[model samples]
Target: MQGALRFGARLVAILVLLAVLYSAAALSFALSPVSGRPQQADGEPLVYVCTSLAHADIVMPSRDPLIDWSTHFPAVTPPGLPAGAYLAFGWGDLRFFREVPTWADVRPSIALSALAGVNDTALRVIAINPPANDPDCRALRVDRAGRQALIDYIRATLADETQSRPVEQAHLEAYYLARGRYSPLRTCNQWVADALAAAGLPHALFAPFSFSITWPLEKPPLLPGKS
Candidate 1:
């Protein structure tokens, strides 16, 4: 019994050490210079990166002159959306997303399953207004070509471009089946970074955490009367 207890303690210590090392590596990468140069994306044709500390979402205009997002996301019109609402796209583990809306809801088994890349993934789309002055949002300039590349990258991650069923949920959000698997290496934040890199926009070398991707952008302060 004593030997078993010692073995368990050692295992716990090893896990803790691993977690610390991972965090340090992530921080180092986040502080390092980004990998790519900014495309010819000047002040116009802006896109936003919204972060919830733990996750990241790519926010784009619902409709533009070159692309009609509604046609691609047919069943994604949530209520109270204005005429020209924006859409926030997030890719994550299906079960983790559906079950754990917040960190408090995370369970060890579910987290392990997601990290193991054993379960499928989904894309969560939220129709929102322009996140102006919101601290969680940071804008990025993308020219027409860069915008098209970003859109193409996002579309390729969809399980079906023609038809998709929205996951039944109470929030004004739609979740669709996604093409990629969710693992420790390809986290949701990493997906956002990859999308940016695909468009030749500024992005991190390794973005396993939200800050790793958002590190280069400026974060506005929280609005008055808001958290």
Candidate 2:
């Protein structure tokens, strides 16, 4: 009986040691931070990793259709305005379209939609995009020449600005409405590629689906490529 008791105790001790080692390793991994670009699944590049809140904030702006509502909706006058008058008068004074649209605009809606459907307790929405290797393909890298052109356009549009506030309000309303919806994380690769094409930059928007593993325990073959 004493021998059996000793054996049981030894087994317990071994189990305890294993548990401790496993716990230590797990803690180390959890505490460590990942660096550099996320690995591509098929061909898509991962650009940003952030919480749903952060993602939401970035995407709301891009989905906004920069339209001059006063010009577009000349027939529909603002409420409480006279027949000959307009709503949001003098709105064109402020500069609009200072920055180009990006994927950040639609991230919030995406997060909200995903959270609504899935169990967000253990899972996270991972967004992937194409690599921003070329200067013309990056919003941040809107070159001096491009910046000048954009500014010139804005100045020209706003120069004879008659209905500034109404147009601005329309944009603001659109932004708020989009914010209320599920704005998915935009693949900046596509946005940049589009911008490049519009600007006559030599680059193509490649829409390839891919996956990545943010955790170390995740084995290889992280994500399958989808073209």
Instruction: State each candidate's clash count.
Output: 0, 21
Model 1 lDDT-worst window of ten:
216-225
What lDDT score goes with residue 124 in model 2?
A: 11
- Where model 1 places Cα greater than 4 Å from the true spot, the runs are 78-81, 169-171, 218-227
Model 1 vs truth, CA RMSD: 6.1
Q: Indicate the TM-score of model 2.
A: 0.20
lDDT of 1 by residue, 1-227 (tens): 99999999999999999899888888877776354544465456569999987899999988866687877776666444576778899999999998897889989999999999999898888888888777999887777887888889888998887766676544558888898889878999989988988766657767899998788454332233554
Candidate 1 is scored at a TM of 0.87
Query: What ranges in model 2 sit over 4 Å off?
Result: 38-227
What are the C-alpha RMSDs, in order, of all predicted structures? 6.1, 18.6
Error of 2 at 19 (Å): 0.4
What's the C-alpha lDDT at position 2 in model 1?
A: 100
Q: What would the per-residue lDDT of candidate 2 be over residues 1-227, giving only the tens digit for each residue?
A: 99999999999999899768755643453334132122322332112211121111111111112332334233333333232221111111011111213444445544444435331111011112222342212222233343333223322333233433322233223110011111122222222222323322233233111111123212222232421
TM-score of each: 0.87, 0.20
The positional error of residue 105 in candidate 1, measured at the CA in angstroms, is 1.8
